[model samples]
Target: MTDALQAMKALIEEINHHNYLYYTLDQPGIADADYDKLYDKLVAMERETGIVLPDSPTGRVGDQLLKGFDEHKHRARLWSLDKAQNHEDLTAWHTRAAKLVNDYNTRNPENPLPPLSFVVELKFDGLTLNLTYEHGRLVQAATRGNGVVGEGILAQVKTIKSVPLTIPYTDGVIEVQGEGIMNLSVLEAYNQTAAEPLKNARNAAAGALRNLNPKVTAERKLNAYFYNIGYTDGLTFADHREMVEFLRENRFRISPFVRYFDSIEEVAQELDAVVSMRNTFDFLIDGLVVKVSDMRTREALGYTDKFPRWAVAFKFEAEEAITTLQSVSWEVGRTGKITPVAKVEPVDIAGVTVQNCTLNNIGDIERKNLKHALGSQVYIRRSNDVIPEILGKVTEEQDGEEIVFPEQCPSCGSPLELKGAHLFCLNRLECRPQLIGRITHFASRDAMDIETFSIMTAEQLYQELGVRDPADLYGLTFDDLIKLERFGEKKANNLLAAFEKSKQCDLASFLFALGIPNTGKTTTKVLADHYRSLDKLMEATAEELVLLQDIGDIVADSIVSFFRDPVMQRSIERLLQAGVNPVSEEAPVIMNAENPFFGKTIVLTGTLSSMSRDEAAKKLEALGAKITGSVSKKTDIVVAGESAGSKLTKAQQLGIRIIDDEQELLQLLNG
Candidate 1:
């Protein structure tokens, strides 16, 4: 190799090692800033030299967009694993595997039992990708499109920070197979800002990897953990566990949850443990992949055309059931959009009796062709093991009649209009349901957090006290509340007190509480923080509003339209007249506080020793400190406690200050 080529190889090796440490091991030998500096230096060097190595990280970006996916035949056929749905199914699979191995050994006679052992690993909820490496450099990465042929995703895969551009093992050639998964935290954060949230992590990862922009794929933070060597030269292992350990040592991202078991019962127990701990993990896992540990036994058991006889995926049972749609009702949300809700005859799914499910919007009703007629048989499926959704009409016409969309708002009798598939109540102020929903939303924990006012109280105040909107909430009196059904003097006083306290909520929360269309808690906060006051945000033009990150035309228009409403404008004036100061024009500064994070953005990592994460966050917020979700350049302090993982390492690498306990934080706050 020439000097430039050798240097390029060294750079690739260094970057790949860092990638393995950060993404795979969840430990980093260097900080993110330092890593970025190194990466930038290498890129600049390649640019200046004008001699790019074939395996250089810069070579990953495709020069041109392809019209469609082109399939390349797989070197080795990728087969779908047979699945065991429940414990019984798992036991049956184990018994079958044992029997197959025992029968094979008996036939051989001289081979003996072959030492039966199994390797159990988490079945990641992601797209399977096959990566081929030549001379320790990743040459090709392809999606497992149809088991036989897959679209070449090498260019896209190279953008993934987790996938190493060069393999650690400097061998002849190796083909490693793994699943490309979008981290659950990343997906959740993405969805919070996404126009339409993805259904699950797997779909998000798959969609992100296929995007035209490599930068977009890079932003998704897609990760991969190699589970099997599809084909490798000059290496052999007696057991699957040993092979996984070998891969780990070689700086390959190996499956972390792999466990070895000696008996069928032991395997079942381990699988159960894995399932129980699923929620605690940061990535999505759909099932457990169990394979015979002994390579000799696996060979003896052999494989079928579609699956391995030695291995099976023990999948978690689908949380789904059939129920009768007893009634369908239209609920006017705070934003005046009508949502269809299905009241069903109770049916047990995943140990819970689900009697009600969200129909999302009118689009869902029409898509599912859900009839309002009572007694409609509907099949409900929990999408991704949570949030019940009506799949489709199970049995068409039951004893119930077909339901029709209401021509008028159910709460205010105002005529409704169909904006796209949604029924909108034009009476933004007078609509009783809308008013109640707005108040409830404003009082929600994510909003102003009026702890004492219940949704029922809001509704009652709207109906009984003739209150039309949130501002009218201030017009309420202790006497008026006491006269309501089930209201005592003490309850009435508490409700009034909460309403009074809510007036002091910051500008951002107040903006969020207004229930403007497309304005969520985060967006409202950004708008409020950016503008610093309600009047400034109200004066923002559509073009200006759209300039904010996560804000678009629809949201900007909604905001402008909200301020333009005569009733809403009058309500704002009334709130001002009633001494309801919504905005904190100036943030109070803690001067010379002992706390190290007086004016900095501090994030709590892992489980805190002194208090719950929420408690720590609350305490920090009380001390004029800004709390953020992730470790970025803006983060000034990271209070790491027990089990501090990625965030702690990232913070340390960034050279952000750290504190160990709440007392230290308190001192900072006081100082």
Candidate 2:
């Protein structure tokens, strides 16, 4: 029994030490599997002996579910900071603070406060967390409820791996304030597999923390970074920097980006730099917090009823807005999938007028509790230059109508089939929108490269010429086109010439133009390269297709299903009969280890005057350079061209190599 107790103690200490190292220090000394083994052994010992230490790591598993949160009184109030949206507002804040400092100095010459230096930290977009510690152990955790009092959520807070259960400061009681955040990457991963995807990171973190079950909070994998010591007994710090060091020494996760500036001008420049690189951060930051560095200065310039005079939050431009969801309109794609687009009352978001918001699918609508959101106020967010998405309804009162799902296709009046969360129109051949979309996509620049073929042309061909399918396009003669209203002799000849040019397209382009269910250009390229012929690709089993690098079960199934369709087969046969021959254009690429770009991940941004981005990507791929769409730390090089945007900025911030000169890029490609 003695030996078991000793072993349990040793294991507990070792696991806690590793947890501190991994979470607080960001320096993991032990592998995850090894750490888990140690944790499991400790758990087994505790179960056998029926004895668990007060601070045992196993307590963080969150087995207990709470009925409700008990209110906790904070020793020191958590004051909100005044907000400054622009430089002018920030300048005004600085002027007021400077004036207050001057007045204080004039009143008390002998005990004048030191110079008002500033501490700038990123304003993390998350839920506010206040952790109370007494005698080196975490006693309570709470939200910033009415400043002085909050709902206790210690169990939920403990599930956060980075939050310390015990601190080194055992002298007396202390309250540390921080933000509980769900990392953007973690949120994205969770949403990909979640039954109902979370709208945003901030809400995800907040909802997890406020949940009745601690297990729910643990599942979120929350993280916290302490910034302020709101209450402390028998502890004194000269400045914010010293306080931050104290937090760091006590194994608290302090942000590495805390910067001290003497002048507001320097702080303004730093804010700009932060804004430019904000997208690169794993966590969301809505703005920055600027606070007086010196504790004495902070004390001298006290607080108002709601906010501190010494500190201010610099808010960025609004990316979200609340607007009435007027109605829902279902739109069909080339794949026959039905999408619900919410038409909202016109509202401006981030300087753009947004009326329509994406609801993703019917599952998203139900999951987000937005089924009855029509005519109700809904929260809409515009981010990353994509179409705005309706997050959820602002209130649950349901002062709106329930969105009725269409029984039949709006365009073709065919029975709509519900597949998973999406509604699909099985009537693929006759559906106007679906057929038009497929034909338009086939003639797109990345597909068949059919010049002079527009959506208007497709519509005219569909209605006037009775062109039902892509196969029918090949049968069109100059006479058929010249008879149409706006078609002249030169235009007719050009259309015929383009059709002739499109017939001899590469296998990859031809495959892409076919509009296979889930297969994209990249997948088609992979299929073409692997098979080297269309016949081999058609004969490939899903099992064999899944063996490829990027091909998964979903894509493999899609490929097999597309090729086996009788209609698709007939369409291909008709194209072949019309002299449409898709041949493999790729010569064998020999990978050279000596090549500079070999095994490197490269991103191409902006326009390359010498060639199209696609042409450049192919050339780079020939030399063993892997092309990617986005810039990240993993990107080895960025081929920046004229008028590069956010990707270029991100590459610069990450210190990735950039090739801006066209001549230099040409030299590398040619060589």
Candidate 3:
């Protein structure tokens, strides 16, 4: 070999070693910057010399031109997951699975339903691949092509860093099914510099895998999470969870979010929790995969040609829709920022009828040219499955009508000023729409937990009851509510009761209820816990607010803006005058040095056998435990009883540690 070729080989070896350490073993000998420098040097050398080794990392970008995929019949038919659209569908699927298991157990008492349990995993939004390993070495890999037959992609699959070239399972063949996913962060970073950005992570992965150069594929940093053992020899796992554990133990890249649940409710809770934290995860997950634990039970349940009866994917509602844009209307939010809303023909998206989609700001509208037509076909997608956004215009025809930016606010008719892309309404206190939205936000469950006051009710109360703001809500009487259209005595009474109940909320909740732009429940709680009173919090400056944990410039600015408002100040004063007491300062109990439950949040549900609820709470408090009435992300342990309700369900959903009895609690506390 030439000197340059020898040097290139050495550099490639070094790069591969570091890559294995960083990606596979989670241990890096050198810094990422240093590794990148080494990789760059190797690439430059290879380019200069025009000599490239076959097994070099640079050679793994694209797959070789295949004549065609070799037809290979699967040992067992790979069935798709039966999809559940919503919670009701999920419950129905669970019920059917349970009934099937019960029937199986009844018929064959001796060989019962092998301890029914479920392995819940995230259904990745990517291509699925089936990898077959013979005698611990990867032999073949194929796509899930029509379940029965698949194209061979073994040579290309070997390039994936996560796909192990060899496994620990000896003297047997095992087919592992998994998703080939592109990391969202990596895709975003690549898109930032690329001339054309990929639409999503799934599409990015698909494009990268089909690339002509294997080196390009390696550059994408694709990952795989093996979930199913399609065909295994000399390994008899009774349940899905066990099989997952086995795969994990054998150094296979398994889905980290996979969990075992005892009941269907647990599965539902898991699904909800996954949806809640979907944004936080690095990879894209479309839904939750729930499978019957027992292999025999699964076999008995059997499969249709398309989907398995025993397994179901609880899919979240679709966030994308194609619709005709009827017109565009600019609306001012609570912050006085003018958002151009596309008045589209009503389209069902994500389980809700979306008639209006936010154009974000003037810049967004102008860039997309959303306001050019009265009847334009448009594609819309929800960002993070929450906020509706217009992707782009589909049609090219515009009736030569120029789209103009609104000079005045839609609600208050106040003059608008352009602050960069956002048109700001100067009428803060007088804007009726802003006031209504603010009041509704304040009374929301995450803020003050005012159950009865919705947006419509707030609007009616504003116009009919002569209430301008949230403070005016306290002035409303049952008689006033009863007088409104469609409001009966019972509904009025309930609203009044809810309003009354909200008056005694904690200082944190009250702070959040102020509808400050960036202040959320957790931030409010932190501020309230630290300051302990609204008076102290109100006195705090922007700098002081920013000093708190997780408080950034945006949040600090919002807090300062809210407090600086004369109308908001008057509202707070009026609330105080109306006998709204927001003081709930519970001193944290200090525990002994030897206390077992130091730094743990525990929730008690149902009735305790050994101790009263209060007694149990007191004991936990004595051990330096912080007690919360509800189970949330904050709750660490849940002491469940015979019939624990939603709290228990939420606890399980959040993956909070649960203790069934007093003994388990004691063990956890001590440990």
Candidate 4:
């Protein structure tokens, strides 16, 4: 009961947030089908307890005209099915069924349970309707409002051509439950000139169905699928399959993808197939519903106050949406790479409002065939934590203007070069974006460990002192900083102190901090492992660099090109003069055959209690251990501390030895 209350509160908040996204912001996160799943659950809860929250979306009617549509009492109550997000949840449900069946078998040994079979069908994402037929003609249609009394959208529902106005053999009172939907094409057409654009097809169908005018609904070209029998008399079906067969034989529109699975594994596998072909359908679908085949079993496994224990919906991740591609926001990276970020009109995909998603490069733009000229609508995907990716342009509805790529840098006005797949700016040292990126990289924990320095402070330094390079940061004075907006005497002291502290960083740290193109932390570690000293690496020829383990021709050229720059050379010299010393990793290591940590792949993750992660890695490297970035089968050990994530899980799965903290690591290092 407590769980139900919490679920009710959560559902209310979630539904209201989606409502704001759809109705107000014009950017809905989830599709109408997904929204229905959540709404159905809330309604089921309300029906069970008769407890309704004032702010719940279940209590609310259409966007407008609540009083316009006449209310009609439903013949029988409507209920919503609970959902399962993953295969594990589905398996758990099956496990519960096994327990129930086993208990039943114990009670009646002579009537042992038969092999469990189930039906899996595509779950439509649209508005639910309860249609009633008298004799051989459709009499009324209703929206599932509070499950008891519904808004009589009979005039509007009659506009749907897919619904059968007259079916043969329709005797006594018969109530059929189905979904009212609009196709992708029709929704697109309606949104093109609507006063306020429709977010998706489901929402469009819903609004049209509840419309006071029947003609408004007629123009939408709505469709529907009848799946469940709500209220029935003078009919006795053996099972769900028999009833669905009746609907299909009578020419009622039903989903095409329906199959019987003898096992949960087969059902789970079929779900994967459904997902793969989800986009093939003309209409949208959220998930597939799995139900017990035997009506007797369904009766035995009765209702759990809300949904039936006999069935559960297997939902997929959020569906995709198409929206206008307003324009692109081009920005420069630390490597002077010009990236194209799409500025899309707010659209919801999978419960996320996406406005900006990266297009990567010119090649990517051409390959995806994006018109990208400020008016074309694009196909975008929004998944959890994933940056929305523009699939491609869906329509060519755009203004007759083209977005020309600039040859000159937007920041420093230097000529841009087409470097392979990306655009690069020659003005590396002077460009504000690159300069800030470089300084931010330099002050990063894995680089120089300058904790007090930030991008804002870097900007302040640039504006005040014209400090344009990473080395220019070390030359800043306490007096120079004290004049800035937020820098007080204490902050000035802290900044200077942090700067002084970074000078004692390791050789690999300094190389990584230099912000040399393509020389990431891993590459620096490889260089540190091979060359043993920063000066030796700086003096090495490109030919010599290419001979090293992981160093490729491109990386070698980048290293040679960086050291050849007189400006970069001066910057390094000035940094050295300012007391920045790149130290070796303690002592040179020789292979000791019996050393406990010898020639083993180890990964370091999270914060170390004693020293920084870089320091610990270097120390372990000095003891003939190789510190790697990721955990794999080759990894002999994983040194994990607090807040360990996926790496820890991988290590545990592989049965690899784990060093809990620096203490255990040190113990193994000395042993």
Candidate 5:
């Protein structure tokens, strides 16, 4: 590497660390004056050398934002790693790895393999960014949109101080891939000036990098830490750990924590250690990336199209945080249920700021004794991006005070009633939260399919137009919407069009939209199949409901209770009066029983030539095929593509029929 290039790499790394301290962790260890001096020196050096690296921060200086992002084809495919959520899955994967290694050793007696070892690193929860450097100079950067082609954010990425502008060149082109994310500290700073609350660090980094405004991306202060050296012209390593160490030596921002183990059991221990220390890092991590250490072994194992065969990700189940609950506040649901929401100190969990956690019901609070104490530390769990829930109170100081459940409606102050593990506010028509929540649900995608409707819009309709129930939504006219604050003629027309489109939703979806407690999509389907229409299902007795498949006593009673409520009856009548007629589905089209695939559980793997996997699954589902996620004892068929891996092996062992091509898939579905 040239002297200028060496200095540039060092300067870039120094600047990146400074950025990490200030922008990422919100702890600037160095003074602004000292940082400014280093930056000036870098600019002067760049000018003297007349060699501006592609990822040089100097290029970002005074650079205007591009009008739009353009697509850049990745030089190499960025394959995803297969994931294992539990020990059993990981053990299964490890067994497969052992088998492959044993087979390789058997094939080549002279080069017998050692016990399969792995290198583990934190699996960052963020967008994948590929930064390519040619002859030691950073040249291009792209988002890993579809593995092959990604939106170009070269200009935006140049502003990331942590990305090296140049490196020590000894070989051909180097493609470095990393997780690009805005940490919680950066999110806090950005939200201060942003018009909206950024959902999380990962999304914020993705959106910031793709923003048309380069300055905006710079202002957000994105960070990245390289994990894999995806492609190289002439570089080779005996193992993954050596290659990563080389990357670190060359001034790349590699992961700080790296460990190697000879056994899967040892790797599992490391995984636990990583999870325990995950929150202490500046970046967001969702799991641990475990890779077969030997490069030769990796080559022997090869890869599947969707995932690398030599590596797997042990993903964490949930993001949790312990925070003190300050007090309890009751909020009335659409069903007139007054649920407790524990207001807590703002805690970060699952990358989002949670100020309050749901207590479910009065019965739940009494059972857990959460409301019995204020200023008590509580376990808040955020699962699958759902609302945070207060799991239970944690042991803390004895000064915590007892919580008193409210006896009246939080919104309307009406006397509350107790009914089987729930506290209800009988003022259903008047409670503001109930009205808004119900209207929001009714207009939601799964319900009425009103795309233009939102919680904000629902609140406006209820407060301004007195939308007492879901049915009143149909009465909204363009003229009425035109009077709202942000709604103009075009917005009004769009909302009206959405409403008109929703009037045609089928019986199952409509039934689910009623917001019946404990009744989900499958329950709605069962109900629709049995009764054929909404009114028939509503008129049925609890005994009739209990007779159906999967319908138990509690669900039956809830269904009956909802239908018998006078307010609910009036709501349905209003919906009928508004011409919101739900069409019943005809008897399900019976697939020929003679078809071999009918009633068979099947799993799909790898890329198919004719159509996408999702499209294939839909067509097969229509023909009575059950699409499954993994290969198992119950899987009757396996669809294998060019690079199908572990699942294919499992299917072969189980002696299941393996379909090879899209043509075969089409034949099976058509027959």
Candidate 6:
């Protein structure tokens, strides 16, 4: 029994250390398979002995579903910070804090506080988490409920690998405050394969934490950043910097940025700098947090009824606002998906006047409880700088006119059908909007690379030239194009040249131009590389497709169904007849095993002067290289070009191999 306990203790400590290294430092001490073996051994030992250590790593994987969250009283109150919308508001806040500090110093001259220095950190847009540790062991984790109390979510919080199960600080009791967030890159990766894509990272993190199933939370792979030791029974610090060091010593995952500034003017300048590079961060941040550096000054400044006087949140311009929904219009996409576009009263958000917001579909409208929200105030947000989307109605009781869902296609008057969370019109060929959308997408830069092509051009060709399918574009001549309303001699000749140039496209571009449902550029590229020809891809079975990496059942089904459709087959026949020749230019007769880039995950960033990045990627793929968008520890090499940005910097920081010279890149491609 003693030997078993000792073995368990050793295993627990080793596993916890590895978790910290991998999650907090982004440095893996061991391979995943090796770590799993150690974990399996520990689990087997635990089961055999029927004894689990208090700080056992196995507890991170919560096997049982929680019925409900129990209320927990926090050791220290989680205070909210006062917000500063502009520089004026921030200046006023600093003035108030300085005044309070001066008054305190005057009264107690012998014990005068330090000069009013400030610490600035990013105000992460995520769920506030309070983790309570007793005798260095994490005992409880909770949400910030009314400052004084919170709902215990220990099981859910444990799933975060960055959060230490046991800290080096063997304090009596302590509460650490941090924000839990899902990285934007992680969110994008999740959305790619997820059946129901998560709308935003902030909401995704919050929803996962509050979920009844810890398994669901684990799947999200959330991360956290500890900023403050909210409560401590056996620790003291001279200033915020010292406290930060203590947090770091205890193996808490802190943000890389914790800049200290003595002058308020410097702090303001720093805020501006942060705003400029805010998008570069992997996580989402709404603003910067300016806090008093001196702990004694913070104590002297004290707290107000709602917010702490020592700190202020320098908030960015509002990205979300409530606007009255005037009407809803259903628009048809290239895939026949009917999307609901809500025309709202013009409201300014993040400096843009938003009059229209997306409701996604009828199902999305119903899911968001916006069925009876027309003419009512609806909450809208500009997600990822794209078109603003309607979150929901402000009032849940629905005190306005009902938003009627269209039973028929608005463009072609065909019967609409619900497939999952979207409404689809089966009228593919005749629908004006659908045909126009299809043609526009087919001529897009990433697809057919048809220069000077726009939605207006597609519309003109459809109406004036009697163009329907993408194949019709190939048949267009100078005489036909010159007859159009906007077509002059030069414009007609340029359009004809572009059309001719696009006919000799590569297979990957041609496949992407087809715009198969549930498939994007990446998947189409994969399909092209795997089959090496259009006929082979068209003949591929779902079973064979699923064998390819990243190609799931849904995507495979979408591919198979699209090619098997008689309409699509007829369209392809017409395209072939019109002299459109899409060749597999990058297909190697025999893949070389000795190639340096073979089987290596490579990333391309910035502008390549020799060739387009897409063209370079295809050449690399032919030599058996896998190209990814983002740079991470997993990335083997980064092919950087002129003016490489954050990705290049990250690659350098991670010590990944970089190929920056254009001549070197050209040699590699040619080699």
TM-score to true structure, per model: 0.46, 0.46, 0.47, 0.47, 0.56, 0.48
The stretch of ten residues in a row with the least summed lDDT in candidate 2 is 59-68
Local accuracy by lDDT, each model: 0.69, 0.78, 0.69, 0.74, 0.73, 0.78
The candidate with the higher lDDT, 2 or 5, is 2
lDDT of 2 by residue, 568-645 (tens): 999988988998899996664677988888899999877789898878999889889988656656689999887666
Candidate 2 lDDT score relative to the true structure: 0.78
Candidate 1 residue 394 Cα shift, in angstroms, is 3.7
Clashing pairs in 2: none
lDDT of 4 by residue, 1-671 (tens): 43454445445554654565554333455444446555656777877855553245554342221445677778667765776777887998899887887787788677566667999988887788999887668889998865666778899999999898888855555788999999887887877888887666766787888788899899888999988887653454657889899888776898777798789899999998988898888777878899988766675676664477889988777446788778876777666767666788987564346776556566667677764456777777653222456777775544424556778888888999876556778787678888887787788655797966666777888788888877888888888889889889998998898898888988888888886654556677778877888788889999998897756676677788988889889989989998999986655656697887788888876567777776777777877888865665668988887656567777899999998866777776666
Per-candidate total of colliding backbone pairs: 12, 0, 9, 2, 2, 0
Model 4: what TM-score?
Answer: 0.47
Error of 3 at 145 (Å): 37
lDDT of 3 by residue, 1-671 (tens): 23454345444444554444433232333332233345445657755764443224453321112223465556545666656767887888878877888887898787576656787888887667888887788888876654666656676677788899988876556788998898889888888888877656765675565555667767777888889888653355667877888888778898878788888788788888888888788988877788888776776788653467888877665455678877777766555666665677886542245666555566666677665755777877642222355767777666424557888888888999876666778787789877886787788655677866667888888888878877788888887788899899998898888888888888877887776654545677788888887888888888898898867665677788878888779989998887788985674556666655777887777667776667778778867887755665556788886556566777778898888876877675555
**Model 5 vs truth, CA RMSD:** 16.6
Is 4 or 6 the stronger prediction by lDDT? 6
Ten-residue region with minimum lDDT total, candidate 1: 58-67
Q: State the lDDT at 131 in candidate 1.
A: 89
RMSD of each: 24.1, 25.5, 23.5, 22.2, 16.6, 24.2
RMSD of 4: 22.2
lDDT of 5: 0.73
Residue by residue across 509-547, what tens digits does model 5's lDDT show?
888788776565667778888899787888999989989
Pick by TM-score: 1 or 4, better one: 4
Stronger candidate by lDDT (1 vs 6): 6
Name the Cα RMSD for model 3. 23.5
